[model samples]
Target: MQKEELYKGMNPLEAAVSGAALEGAVASGLSDPFGSLDLLTIQVTPLAIGIRADGNNFVPIIPRSTTMPAQKDLIFTTAHDNQAEALIIVYEGEGKKVEENHLLGYFKITGIPLAPKGVPEIRVILDIDASSVLRVLAGVLMPGSHQPVNPVMGVRMPTVDDGHGWCAEALNRAYGSTLDLVTVHKKI
Candidate 1:
């Protein structure tokens, strides 16, 4: 959808607050306390509606984009319930084996009142960078090369070249699976 369609004239703050409340409710219902929210199931609507928190109303909107490691921006109204909160967790891969440590960002909305959970709105913008995949793999293969706070003895550190190879291998391994390299930008 178009950017204008997402906003529907609501200001950033209004979008952020409403989005956060809906997200907070979903987070509260998850089976795993620390699990990331599933992006595939989230339905994108054109306008905000009467999603209530405490006694207030809210509206949420997610932007449109075409890229890997999708970026999301959420906005909603201020909420009253302490239980009302929002969080964004980034994971590696599309399956159960995805790494949680790869989490890139997290956001929360607190101090919302119990009565006016629906009045105010909120806005959130998210951008996902997959470059860390390379870094993480490099660290795993060349343990000492990058240098962690406490390096264990007898551990071999791989060089930057090795990291590059690992990154390529990872992309290859994911070939025909969930990973594919695409030309994101073209020279003018």
Candidate 2:
């Protein structure tokens, strides 16, 4: 199935919360306080890589990989009397799974404030590399078609302004794209 099709009918926040709870259970070997493990079992219905956390615990799952370039959304909810935190790792470059595993970038969210003892969600999107894989798969699956050539570099830049002009500029040059800026000023 196509990667995009996986996450078409799911809520991002709900996905994140479920992902986090699953990972938390695996990583920490702890039971969920909310008694909602059933929801967490629903196959991650998104086409992206995600790591969810319940406090310090986490779990990693990717519905789509480099062969699939579908964006996915994830959510993680914290239990009462606790908070949530997470680290997401992305791997890029040419190599087998063993080799590529070492080359990765980490996105971390820390100290997510505690929600009232029910469920609060943290949402994120996962965009995979379907275009690249499509080319490769097409060539192999359908010979005489154009052979897929892996790009020299494949990376995604963050959309939010992280207060680094040079970094954004560099990213723009690399991707041949422009950034849209929205500035808000508050009067004291």
TM-score of 2: 0.29
Q: What is the TM-score of each candidate against the true structure?
A: 0.22, 0.29
Question: How much lDDT does candidate 2 score?
Answer: 0.35
Error of 1 at 70 (Å): 6.3
User: Each model's RMSD to truth, in Å?
Assistant: 24.9, 22.3
Candidate 1 regions with alpha-carbon error over 4 angstroms:
1-65, 68-71, 78-107, 111-115, 130-188
lDDT digits (tens) for residues 1-188 of candidate 1: 65544546888898889878757766577554665554333433222211112221121211223343444433333323322332212222222222211222222333333333333233333333443121111001111234322221121112222323443334325432211111112121
* RMSD, candidate 1, Å: 24.9
Error of 1 at 69 (Å): 8.2
